[model samples]
Target: MNRILIVDDEAEIRESLEEILSEEGYAVSSTSSGTEAIVLLRDAPYDLLLLDIWLPDRDGLDVLADLASLETDDKPEVIIISGHATIETAVKATKLGAFDFLEKPLSLERTLIVVKNALEARRLRSENLEFKRQLTLETTITGESVPAKALRQQIKLMAPTNGRVLIYGESGTGKELIARAIHSESPRHDRVFIELNCAAIPEDFIESELFGYRNSAITGGPAEKRGTFERANGGTLFLDEVGDMSLKTQAKVLRALDEQSFVPVGAAHPISVDVRVIAATNKNLEEEIAKGNFREDLFYRLNVIPFFVPPLRDRKEDIPSLAREFLRIFGREYGRPRVEIAEDALDLLKQYPWPGNVRELKNILERVLILNPHVHRIERKHLPRLVYRTTGRRSDDFSTLQQAREAYERDYILRKIDECHGNISRAAESLGLERSHLYRKMKTLGISIRESVS
Candidate 1:
């Protein structure tokens, strides 16, 4: 049976919540003091907590701040109850990690509905998390080269520790893959492994996105949400492209890293989380620090477990193994019969300086498989023109010109849609295309635009 805890100073209120919840087949517990609530919560497991914002002996927000320090997975979902709450206090409660803010004149019907929804949501979330973990494929280093073997060894050595890690590598060098590998081997393997690309989000949204904001925290903001640190509690948080983060945000992250707690964007109360931090970057951070673009102090904190991912060019010996693996996967995915890459073609792949790293190799192999419909064994002659050249640009002289154009156009449309707020009409107008024509193009390209504002 699901468990519920009611923490209200008013004896009548606590009795009401407990009687209502118990009638609905829930295991119920009640407390009138914030101090006793904290003790009970620490001692036992409760699925949900009904917290009062104001108490006789202490403020209820302080109890929430205390609950936020929980180190166990059984931390209860908190719903704040208040009789005289301002919008500001409601938002502050939300930022302090309250699941929901409820008014004091609680309608029995509304209370039951909210309580049922919160419990069901938690059940669904837990189910989805377990389902995702079961479906995810395991990542292997897939190389026998010196660098690859050394990296595997280093990960084995560092996976058990709680030290913060800083990974250095070029784009597509499998930094994320290595991070996941470490997580999989670590003590926190069963927990979540959250990732955020620091470069992908804009400067203003970065703070709110990472630390989250309460409802209506900023001028015309969206609803309350949990941030990365909170979501990754008791797990690992991988910060990709950490060099791109602004120095101001870096300082805030540094403070949270040190204290394991932080105030949300517009809330006074602070929430604490226990998250293992793993940061990755492609830029020379030393140079960025010298130029005052990166934080020196944050760098030292994250660099406790320094790791350097070898670029594809430096680990050329791994190319053949990686290439074969990609070919096998793509061959099955593209519905092509079994195929093979000749020795000469494999040698040519090794000769090329893969500036895009392993990602380029995977994409190129997929293209080769799709383009070679009749050839079961890929030869050097079947490779694209850009593969052997210094530049990736294709002239009209290439045979795969049409295929390359369609691929580029598909990518361009996706980017335009993101920039246009997922609005097909806006994206079409910006791209100088008629609405109907753009609709047809999107259908032909297998693109689904959900925000179809007419």
Candidate 2:
């Protein structure tokens, strides 16, 4: 059953919310004071909370601060209610971790809709957590290299503790794979592993998206929404690309890490959550700090369990194993009996500096499988142009110094044409060549002017 708790000093307000929520088929609880409300919340689990900002004994925000200090997983999704709270208070409550805030004259339709959405959000989270638990039993770390072995051992030791984890690696270096490995090995493996890509979310909405929003409607909708942090209760929250988060949002995050609770955007009551945070980033966070873009305190909090993913260049010995794994997967995908790697091709692969890392390797293998037709072995000739180097040059010779300069000019003109923004005239001006000359040079270079410009 969906459970809700209403905390307000006014008896009528509490009764109204309880009656409406209960009629909507929620198991509802109400309290007339923040003090008693906290006590009640501590005793039982609630899916959502309706918190009033003012109380006779203590301020609702103070109650939120206290709730944030608690060490438990049953913290409620809090919505703050206030008669005439300032914008500053609302923002502060949100920064502190309130789900959202509601003004005095609350609408019944708005309240019911928000309540339903919050309940549904919680339900989806529960389902996702169950899925993660199943994934944990099925997945395993694949490589047998020294770095992989050491990483697995470190995860085994660190998973049981509550320390935050910072995972650093380049793109496709499998930072998230390692994070999931740690979570699966941890005490909270059975709980949800919620992820937020800080770089993917727009800077304007990062805070509300992370902490959540209170009474405010979902963008382009009439109903309110719950954030990822609330959804990850009793689990691990993974912040991928965390270095991309804006400085403003980073400060709020630092506070949440310090206080262990926060209010969502446009909320009144503070929401408390108990979650182990794991953050991943491709960028150098130290450089980001030097640029004054990241919070120092938050850095310390997350760095308590730092793990670095070794780039493929640093562990070239693992290339053969990784290559075989990719080949097997691609062979099954293509379903062409079976495919094998030639000794020469494998040697070429080992020698290549893979700047794009594992992703690049996977793509190369897939391309080779597709283009090789019925060939059993992938050879070097089937590789992309970027992977190969020719031994000799000087096939086309210039007659004189002026002719060589003209040839260089022709190549430069063709390149400019290719780089232009789909405008022939613009390419002509950019190359300091007449449109007619540019067109003629393009023809001689065997390049279509329109194709090159585009």
Candidate 3:
């Protein structure tokens, strides 16, 4: 049940509110003194708080002032009520994060409605805070190498600035993760963080996707749509694989970046925005520009704050920590205790040249843990041939034919799953296996059927 606290000096008013709220299935508490209300708030959690402006011992606004000092999760939605409330008082309460305000003689109907809406909004805020907390924990940079330290420092320094950032890195080098880190650490952390992949969308639809369309803008345009820029106003817009953007679209994007305004597909009026653009590219944009595939003006516009994400192979010494971090995460997710990596297995990971970079390492570790759920320790005997190749050693790392066969089967199934975009049925069909049988095979092979599907 939603909990509500009422603070009013009038005994009758307090009794009336407490009765009504209790009848409405709320855990209602009322106190006539502002000092006593503060004591109650500090003792327990409340979904909503109702404070009257006039109090004998202390002013009601004092309670709102104390709210800012409390932890974010402990703060309640405050509704200021006053019989002679002025416009200035209402504005002040709003500036202090009041959910809503009501006049002296409260309408029971309006009070209930506001309470319901305020509780719902509070619930949403709590969920969002939890998600952001988890996101911050997961995306934490987890390496101790020099490159890692340097990169973290650069992000810290540049994240607060409004300069456009261009991230250069190889595929699977955690470019998107780094972009999100920059956004989360920036001043606009509370605003939207929009991402678009130039390589994912077709050239014909890319323009409309970035800068939305009006009714009948194209063959199948929606009546009205908010483009990425408008949605990400006062926030961040991350453009991934920007090297793949078409020359025509590049020119349009350049204009938007320069002017912070763009016209929709079927609209003549240009809409202005206040988004910070962050572009990422795996290919060498300078080389692409020389080849006439990428625009030079666009390159300069995006390169205001350039960042190069080092590949996994370049930071081999950081492998043990990164590997263990992944193991801990995957273990918790798979409902298993932390999986241990033998020194040999750790050495192989460090020596291997991760062509796909950190993303590949994460994927391989996830597969390993999901498959070896019952195994407490990962050894060379458990390492896949894909990892063995990185050791500059022969295939003799595995002592048994069964291990080799299992490794081969695991790799083949993973590739098929990728080819089918995580569709188990489609992968089974392509491999000439029954869907049910393939699921059994995956389970037996330690390839988590659940993790693969996503």
Instruction: State which candidate has the highest TM-score.
Output: 3
- Pick by lDDT: 2 or 3, better one: 3
| Backbone clashes under 3 angstroms, per model | 0, 19, 2
Give per-residue CA lDDT, model 1, range 404-423, as digits (tens): 56546655776676678678
Query: Which parts of model 3 are misplaced by more than 4 Å?
Result: 1-132, 217-221, 390-454
In order, what lDDT does every prediction score? Answer: 0.83, 0.76, 0.85
TM-score of each: 0.56, 0.54, 0.61
Q: Which stretches of candidate 2 lie over 4 Å from their true place?
A: 1-139, 217-220, 336-338, 389-454
The per-residue C-alpha lDDT of model 2 at residue 233 equals 86
Give candidate 2's TM-score: 0.54
- Candidate numbers sorted by TM-score from highest down: 3, 1, 2
Q: Write down the worst ten-residue block by lDDT for model 1.
A: 445-454
Decide which is better by TM-score, 2 or 3.
3
Best by lDDT: 3
Candidate numbers, best lDDT first, in rank order: 3, 1, 2
Model 3 Cα lDDT, one tens digit per residue, 1-454? 8899999999988899999999999999888888888788888998899999999998878778887577656578999989998898888889888999878788999988988898999999988998977978755888989988888898899999998999999998878888988998999988989999889999888988899888753456458888777888999999999999999999999999999999988887999999999999999999999999999999999999999989988787788888888988888888876688988678758756788889889999898777666889987556654664423323664567876676567678878887898999999999999999998888776666545765
Q: Which scores better on lDDT, 1 or 3?
A: 3
Q: Which ten residues in a row have the lowest lDDT in candidate 3?
A: 388-397
